[model samples]
Structures are given as structure tokens and as C-alpha cells.
Target: MEDLDVVAWIQVSDGRMLAVRSRGRDLLYLPGGKREPGEDDWSALSREVREELDLELDEATFRELGVVRAPAHDQPRHAHVRMACFTAAYRGAMAATGEVDEYRYVGRRERHLLAPAAQAALDLADRHGLLA
Candidate 1:
């Protein structure tokens, strides 16, 4: 059994949170990714958001949302994911780049469109009153 650790950005707007589909992937996920070796959560999330969304997160605006755990999507049955999540203000327009294929805002009714980890993040955001 392996645990896949990642850092995620939980950006919500107009009752929806930002989600993305990586190239060649079907499930939509939060705009973040796995942390690189020796990288802390802030740096990892910032780097991932920059790579996937083409924007830079403001360190000053960083806020801890919470962490979530779930079965790793599209991975082995025993694989699991532990996602450290946060919210932050960012600079520049957000557009799909790097591994990202499409980016959009999704609400609860659209939950089925996301990966397990992302679904967990969405629920966490809703609990924090960040979503409608």
C-alpha cells in the first residue's frame, strides 16, 4: 500500500470551485498536484497552480482550508491519497497550460465529474462555507 501525498488549492467563485482535467485524463480535479521532494505545501501548491492554471498564488493570501483523504483515482485499489489543501489569491488570468486540458468552475451537482480526491476537497470547501 502506498500513500500519494499532494497539495491542492481550493478556489471558489460564485458557488463553485475551480477544477481541471489534465491532458488525456477524464476526471476533473482541484488546481494542484503532488509535492516534489523537499518542497513544502506552499511551494508545492504554488508551483502546481502555476503549471496547471498559468497563474501565481500570493503567499500573503495563503489560508489553510484543511486536509482530505480518499482512494486514489485511476490507481491501484490499495492506493490512497492524502491531500493538503488551501485557499489563496492569485495573479494573472487562469488558463489551462502544462498538463491541464480544461479548467472550469463546478458546483455540488457536478460532483460526479471529479476524481475521488477532488470530490473530498469539494465537500471540505462546502463545509467551510466556501460554496453554495
Candidate 2:
């Protein structure tokens, strides 16, 4: 089995986390994407968030939220995704950009509408007393 390495942003306001849906996809997810070769977590996540949200992530304010290993969607059955999630301060207005077409804030109860990795991330948040 192979692991898909991904980075995700977990921005919560009033107990709801930021969620996004990419173009041509049905599942909603947290901001961020697969990490490219040679990129550290900060750089990779920053690049992804910039592309998806048109906002610049402040590396200095990054705080790891959690990591989740979940079944990979649209991949081989044996493949899984390891998503490292974080919370960070950012600059610029938040807008759906690049591959992202929709953005919303979601609570734990909305987990059923999220992608697998995002669902796990939200579970982690709830475990940490973040959403409740």
C-alpha cells in the first residue's frame, strides 16, 4: 500500500472549520493539497492554500492541529492518504481560487459532507475540544 502525503489547513471561527470544494469534485475538504517533492510542510501548505484560497499563509503562525490517515478517494483500494493538518494566520482576502469553487464553514456534525481526510481532521478537532 502507498501513502499519499498531503497538507491541510484547519481554520475555525465560532466552532466551524473552513471547508472548500474543488472544481469537478463532489466531496468538500479542508484547504491545502498534496505535498510536492522537496517541499517542507510550511512551504507546501502555503503554496496549496495560496492556490486554493488566494491567501498567503503566514509560516510563522502555523500550529499543527493533527494528522489523519484515511482511505484515499479515487485511488487504488490499498492506497491511503496521510494528511497533516495545521492552523495558520494568513494575509489577503479569502476567495475561492484555482481549483476551488466553493468555500464554507462547517461543524463536526457536517462531517458526512466532507472528504475522508477532512472528516478525520474534524474528528481530531472534536477530540481536542475544539468543536462542541
- Model 2 regions lying over 4 Å from their true place: 76-78
Indicate which candidate wins on lDDT.
1
Quantify how close model 2 is to the true structure by its C-alpha RMSD in Å. Answer: 1.4
Point out the worst 10-residue segment of candidate 2 by lDDT: 71-80
Candidate 1 structure, TM-score to reference: 0.96
Model 2 TM-score relative to the real fold: 0.93
Q: lDDT by residue for model 2 over 1-132, one digit each (tens)? A: 769888999988898889999888888988998778899999999999999999998878999988999988765654788999998989999999999999999996788889888889988888877785
TM-score of each: 0.96, 0.93
State each model's CA lDDT, in order. 0.92, 0.88
Query: What's the CA error at residue 126 for candidate 1, in Å?
Result: 0.5
